[model samples]
Target: MKVTIDQDKCCAAGTCVLVAPDVFDQRDDDGIVILLNERPPAELHAAVREAADVCPGAAISVSEDA
Candidate 1:
């Protein structure tokens, strides 16, 4: 699974980071979403997806590569 974040759309709610800290983070200054892992392992895919789902701004995007 691949993860991407739209910083422009991110509300910096920190939900993504809370859901998947290993895959997401926030900028200290503006509190924008940061992409820690563009390509996370399969084991982390579920968390990454959950993070995307709970994102208040819907800033998180995910793509699955076969």
Candidate 2:
């Protein structure tokens, strides 16, 4: 699974980071969404999906590569 976050769409609410700290974070100054891991381990796929689901701004995207 691959994860991507659109900073332009992010509200900086930190929901994604709160859901999956290993995959998402906030920039220090702007508090924008930051991609901590563009490609996370399979073990973390579920958590990454959860973060994408709960993102209020719809900033997170998850794709599965077969």
Q: Write the per-residue lDDT of candidate 2 for residues 3-66, one digit (tens) a residue.
A: 7778899999998888889888899998999998999998888889989988889999888974
Best by lDDT: 1
- Clash pairs (backbone) in predicted model 1: none
Q: Give the TM-score of candidate 1.
A: 0.95
Clashes by residue pair, model 2:
none
**Model 1 lDDT per residue over 1-66, tens place:** 778889999998998888899999999999999999899988999999999999999999999975
Q: TM-scores across all candidates?
A: 0.95, 0.92
- Cα deviation of 40, candidate 1, in Å: 0.4
Tell me the lDDT of model 1 at 58.
Answer: 92
lDDT of all the models against the reference? 0.91, 0.88
- The regions of model 2 sitting more than 4 angstroms off are none
After the best TM-score superposition of candidate 1, give how far the Cα of residue 63 lies from its true spot, in angstroms: 0.6
